[model samples]
Target: MPPMPARIIHTSIARDWREVYAFMADHEKMPLWASGLSAGLTREGEEWLAPGPLGNARVRFSPDNDYGVVDHLVTLADGQQVHNALRVVPNGDGAEVMFTLLRLPGMSDAQFAEDAAWVEKDLASLKSILESSKA
Candidate 1:
């Protein structure tokens, strides 16, 4: 299949990249910033279970690493799996957190735009929380 269109939604936080990575990599803390996971996640073996838009979802996050990669796979109740690529990179004294949102198959342009906006809002929340924490 052809590659789906993608948008990189990101925000800059006035915090160390490693610190930001540590906070985001912890899936349990995601609901504080990631609105999609506002209901929070519960560990179930190697995967996590969360109340998703389409019912329950199984989430498997990447293992801990030196790099700031916090990628994860979310399996919907309908058996649809979505791969999310997220990263926190150093930007001078601050960090830039980015989330790649792919326009999935059969997704309308308006739906894709809305998804991008949602991601943007989440990233903004992350930036606010992290940056404010330093004060």
Candidate 2:
């Protein structure tokens, strides 16, 4: 199968870049926008576990300061596992978010679409929260 296409979403936040970056990097604030991510645990290294509404999964963060990339292993309640990579790039005033979901051998196209939608929604929510908090 062809490599999964990356979905890109852009939104402007009124807050400064530092505030926006801090909020985005804060794993504890994920549940505010990320669906199914009920809680997150951060380790000293780049590895972390984000508990979904169904089950827990592992995440790996890329070692980069200018750009942020996260690899997510999501386990569905039915025991299905999906791997996805989320990348964030800071725009001049806001940010640009990208999600590259790796499709399993037997995964359907609809599943990829659904995951992309979820990521876009999460980004939108993040933009809303950051912009609304502007002083």
**Candidate 2: worst-modelled 10 consecutive residues by lDDT:** 62-71
Can you give the TM-score per candidate against the true fold?
0.97, 0.67
Q: Roughly what TM-score does model 2 have, to 2 decimal places?
A: 0.67
lDDT, residue 77, model 2: 53
Which of the numbered candidates is closest to the native, going by highest TM-score?
1
Residue 101 deviation, candidate 1, in Å?
Answer: 0.5
Q: Poorest 10 consecutive residues of model 1 by lDDT?
A: 126-135
- Separate clash counts for every candidate: 0, 0
lDDT of each: 0.93, 0.63
**Per-residue lDDT of 49 in model 2:** 70
lDDT per residue as tens, model 2, 91-126: 676565566655566657898777667767787887
Q: How accurate is candidate 1 locally (lDDT)?
A: 0.93
Residue 134 error for model 2, in Å?
Answer: 4.9
